[model samples]
Target: MESARDKRTGEIVDAEQLWIINPVDPMGYECRGCSAQATPCSYRPENKVRPYFSAKDGHNAGCDVEGEVALVKRARKQRVTIREGFPGSFPNRLVLRDTRPVSSPDGSPTAPSSDGGRRTGSNGSSERCRNRHWAAQTIRPICRTFINYPFDRDLPLVVPGVTADTYQHVFRSLKSDQVIQYPEPRLFYAPISWKASIADDDRLEIQLSYGEWKERKLTRPYRVRMDWTDWSAAKRNYVSREIETARSEYMTAKKRGDKEKGWLFFIGRQDESDSTLFHVDDHRLVCCVVNEVIYP
Candidate 1:
């Protein structure tokens, strides 16, 4: 059997630790002896150990591979305690997430009131509700697809610059696009600037993944995305129109006051000529996306 010293207990053991080093960030784990950390390298063995805890005590258990079962259980217990006060004095203390199962008592909640009158959470936690009446405006009924667009407007947009001099202007142009417009109450911003290789005869493509305030309206980890693309700018004027449209999106978002948003961008040239340009065409603007999509 393969054996190694246990890290936490510092005990020499026959059972090994199944450390689950992140596939993306190898540096997540380190050698306790050498104090050397692992980086992203294909050289490491395929079965890198990821840390996990489970039944079968000691090192005998397969641990985390079974999934984060323990964590999920804890979440359920916490939710229950919050929604149905933990057998105690303060009934009002119990609170449920906008998406909790059912209240402690299926019927109604009555908390001791200062004035001696009973207070019921029949209406629930109204203010903190995800769909709280608190909105810029009552959202107009919208298609589910349309409503699911990426929105990151509350944040700033950060686009990397090309030339120190022209960079600002170009950035300003793209900066304007990241803001969220009216129809959708959500706005998005991201700093997108990366280098990529393009082959000849290949069409240029840019993928923009954005996010919005969570669906339930909880500011937690809720977000959406929009895939904007334009194959070939067959009609030069149409390409120009698309650019104008992208620019227009920024203008519209800015006017609505979502100006501080940021977003990402990539430039790649086409290879229809049988030669690898690698760089985008100066005459033709990037056409990976067309038209600004708005969600109401």
Candidate 2:
């Protein structure tokens, strides 16, 4: 599973977050859908595979999470409309909470459900639940939904500081080596260029795939500059490790003849002086995903 509920705090945490935690609690995780024990896997720095949670003894019968995966696949095959709403559950908003609460008023974590709290209709077709949208603690899940449901780009979304309402308008792609004026800030993403990335104590400079290419060499590329001057050592290490892991995953997929690319997603403003440059400071606002056409 991409995420699991922390029994200690009742907060649903993304598997990728394991990198940031100095000491992970071995027995503090459980399945989000059932009372099954979940084990963290491949979370060590040396592990080549991405981190994820696995049920130790398998899930209970009729586990909501198990059924939710199937529902997502079925929804992907169907068409979506604004009137009918999204066929499956999705994180409709991003909520960055400074402190982790024990639980919400309903005694449930704010993390989104895999199935969007689905039910069956008279004809046995999956029907939307009353609570369709859920809150997300990180941008990773939102980015995954954005990539998974390309056809449903018109779905509504709410991100703090961003003016756009729909997914289509919220995400903006960086064009190659362009210094165009950006009147408004949005969640921008670009393919990572492994050859031109820099990581140091001062900051991280990442070159995007889109850039000036000549004789098969990228002469100039769009870059993201993350200021780490005020960040803690642990926070800085987490970002560095994430980038390295993404590069490794991308190379492994290429060696296996898989079509995969590493994408960097962040919500930041364009450089007023250098339009090709974007400055990001918050660690929570940035994420890296490696996939063929979609990501988790």
Candidate 3:
């Protein structure tokens, strides 16, 4: 169990709180399950083990800990599947507004056209919502076929059990189509530069470059939190090592005045907590170093 109720205070006690309670000594907390005595348990941080409460009696009948079951359910909800012959076989009709770059009176950033509505041809026009408002001075709407991608709230776009060849095919198809853009409003993805330290939210900070975002400048860096439990043990190890190596290489390249910049590709639901910032929680699906992705 990751949490247990305090026998004395009647409050829920987490593993970190109990860590300071001196596990070797008697602490006034016990497992909420079965009323058995509980102890705080954790492995070294490098071991990447999630902390949990352990009963003195070991495994008990019907412990109700949810642990792995909860994780599986969470991952299942966020899973994304791009079927074989995805875009080619299944085409989507999207209405894109012609955006003209116009400076504000005070030379502020340009505003994009409000009409970037999308619809599905296979399911008919009513399958998705359309943006209603638009300006009079706009170009004729250009209709294009786009691949429909599934995205989950607060979760990254993960393609489970997908081969690299399939991913490459999808990426190449999206790249070839000039009209296809990243998901908007509820979803977004971009190339970013990472900061060494985490932000106040205890998440990593990443910066999006200019001209990437249409509505906002994204001048400030966004925060991201990686949920390692969503990933398989082997993938977690690989991603960690690759990140370190990529960061080192990026720093070295910068010092040498090379134009090469290490970019991380991230796709996830934007954070509603801040108006100007975005958050990434799905590291397995939509997160990767640009070089690693392009080369691999």
Candidate 4:
């Protein structure tokens, strides 16, 4: 899901989505949210059933940019190039994490960009960020995406496994590199040593979001806590409370039959460090956050 960023707050997840030209599967698509011709290949041709960009109500009718279409004949083949391309340009970019350093498995060096893809900053250090303390996350995912909940799609489940090899194994088995990109950042899951009370049985709830919650008009930052301790009644209660506030809104909409709006499953983590540094790998279970509204 695309997020809006608060520039003043040191770059919150600004939900701006860009239409990425799939190096492979250029012709294989369904629109990415609304029809923007600049990202004509983002969605399939069938999405433009009505033949207009969007109606006043905002239901997309077709691609927004036309005539100067630059979509490739195939997307997956050159998908990596698009990411590692020119360095200064691309159709669209969604920033997932700004200046965050994630440790490598051996904790030796900074980890490379999540997938095998590479990027080159002007200084050239971005080419292999595994050594650097920060990574610039730009995601070009499907217009209609389900990062976690509806795992039915071939979408990579970033939060469900362990081992450094897990990422490569999952990405390699997938049919499309375009699949490498998604509607949202791949679900990053990690194991947490919390006890059974909060996550008794396999049933658990977690909240996934990019920025800090705030009062109306961005009054103040809302505090988020993660329950990684052994399952205690108090822990369960706290988890339940977190669910009610963040996940419940989307759950209610989805379960109560609001199809237009979908939810993104995010592994919840207690950021003892800061709001942006979500230690998802050590997380217990999953949670949902109904992100911003999107056009189909």
**How displaced is residue 240 in candidate 1, in Å?**
1.1
Please report the TM-score between candidate 2 and the true structure. Answer: 0.81
- What does candidate 4's lDDT look like per residue over 59-174, in tens digits? 24432212113322122122313333321111222234424445445432254333222357798564322121111243212222222212223322233232222222222111
Model 3 residue pairs with clashes: none
Candidate 1 lDDT, 126-159, residue by residue in tens: 2211110011100110111111221311111222
Worst 10 residues of 3 by lDDT: 138-147
The regions of model 4 sitting more than 4 angstroms off are 1-144, 147-152, 155-227, 230-242, 250-281, 290-296
Model 3: runs farther than 4 Å from truth? Answer: 1-191, 197-219, 228-237, 290-296
lDDT of 2 by residue, 1-296 (tens): 87776765555578888878768887778776665788888888788777899897998775666566766565456545458656555678988887775545665446434324435889998543444466777888788777766667788999999999998899987775554667888888888886757878788988788866688866667888888899998888787778878887877787899877788899877788877788988888888888655421
RMSD of each: 23.4, 5.6, 20.8, 17.8
Segments of candidate 2 deviating more than 4 angstroms = 68-87, 102-132, 213-217, 294-296
State which candidate, 1 or 4, has the greater lDDT.
Answer: 4
Can you tell me which runs of candidate 1 are displaced by over 4 Å? 1-234, 259-278, 281-285, 288-296
Between the candidate structures 1 and 3, which one is better when assessed by TM-score? Answer: 3
Q: Please write out the lDDT profile of model 3 over residues 1-296, one tens digit for every residue.
A: 54554544333444433323433234444554344577666623453344457776764554434233453344334433345322111111122223324545653224432223223667464221222222211010100001112221211122222222222222321121122233442223333455563433234454444222434533444443454445555444444543554566667777887755555444344455553345454433333332211231
By lDDT, who's the top model here? 2
Total colliding residue pairs, candidate 2: 0
